[model samples]
Structures are given as C-alpha cells and as structure tokens.
Target: MGLFSRRRDPESPAEPFQFTVDKVFVVPVRGVVCTGTVTSGTVRVGQAAKITLEDQSRSVTVSRIEAQGKKRSSAAAGEQAGLFLGGLTMADIPTIPGNDGSIKDGDALSGASVVSVF
Candidate 1:
C-alpha cells in the first residue's frame, strides 16, 4: 500500500455499541441524562440499552441523543454525546458508601457504563 492509501480488513467484524459514562445529571423536564463518548458502534434514539454501574445494571430506553448542543437521531463511535434515558430518576442511581459507611448524597453516576445496546 502507498503512503496515502487506506487499507481495508474484510475479515474484521464490526464493533458492538459501547460507551463510557463520564457524568450523569438530571434535568427537570428530561429526567436523567448520561454524558459520555461513544467508543464504538452506534446508538439511536428510542433504542433500549443496558447501563452498568459497578456491580449494578439497569435497562433503559434511549429518549434522545445530543451532540455539540444539537439533537440527533443517532450517534456513532468517536462522538462525544449525551444520552437521555427514559424512566430514570436521580433516586434510582446507587449511592456510593462513604468512609463512615453512610451513603454519599451527591452525583451517583460519575463512573457508570453503557454496557450493551439492544
């Protein structure tokens, strides 16, 4: 292949949908939103996804996807985006235990993961 030529691997399979959550916040009208980068594959609005947080996991419906402050129907790998999850509230997130064994009363989804897309 030449220096400027692109190589294609026909034997390689496509990647599955995956995202690493960086932050989670609740909006008054939009409910819970998870903001992160889509690491692989694609995610679309209205698709069902599985979110994993530490040892916990929950199924949620994708209500909206936003990138660069604009709403989009779908998001692909390498895009920094936010996914609005339906039927999720701040109360549903698991609280981290403090050093004293008390539940921390702040943002509980800082390190969550969108493990699967369905």
Candidate 2:
C-alpha cells in the first residue's frame, strides 16, 4: 500500500472530504461574457480550467468578482452588480446544494457561494 493509501479488509467504508468556495462571481470588463457549467473550479489563477463546459450554453470569467457578502448588499441581482464589495464572505452563509449549469440573466446570486475544487 502507498503512504496515504486506504486499506480495506471487508470491514468499513471510507468517507470523502468536502471542499467548497463561498463567494460571488463577476465578468471581466473587456472580454465577452460566456456562461458555462463552470466546467470546473479546480483551475487556479495560472491553470487553464479544471472545468468550463456548459450544457450547450456559455459562461464568462468576469474581470473581477464583486463581493456582495462584503458589500453588504442583500438586494436582488440588478442591485448587486454595481458597487464593489469588501468583506463579502465574512458571514458563513449556506452554500449551493449542487453544481448546476443553468444560471441565466438577472439570476439571484447575492447569497450564493462560489464553490470550487482543487
């Protein structure tokens, strides 16, 4: 077995670790906005993209992420788009249940967290 490998003798099962990102998302000012299934968030700053496939749809990587949880904006979609937020993720809000690729225009994401993997 490897150093960090799991062992099984027909005894018990192993549990999984749950990693997530709880924040907001915004499009880059210059580039065209494309909405995808987020594809995957495993990609870091310099990485290509862990996941970026949409359901025959599109998604865009915004110029910057507007931190509303930081901006203190509990308002709807249109309202939360303008001002810049500061300590948005300060509060431990509930994260989105699953990864769905269907965020449409004017979608309400103020309290929605931006979960990522790797």
Q: What ranges in model 1 sit over 4 Å off?
A: 1-15, 94-107
For residues 1-118, could you state the per-residue lDDT of candidate 2 as single tens digits? 6899987657232221111222234434432221212222221121111112222211222222223334221112223232222222212222344557434322323322222222
Candidate 1: pairs in clash? none
lDDT of 2 at 62: 25
Cand. 2 Cα-lDDT: 0.26
RMSD of each: 9.2, 16.4
Q: Runs in model 2 with CA error above 4 Å?
A: 1-43, 50-118
Least well predicted 10-residue stretch by lDDT in candidate 2: 43-52
Report the error of model 2 at residue 10, Å: 42
Superposition error at 77 for model 2 (Å): 25
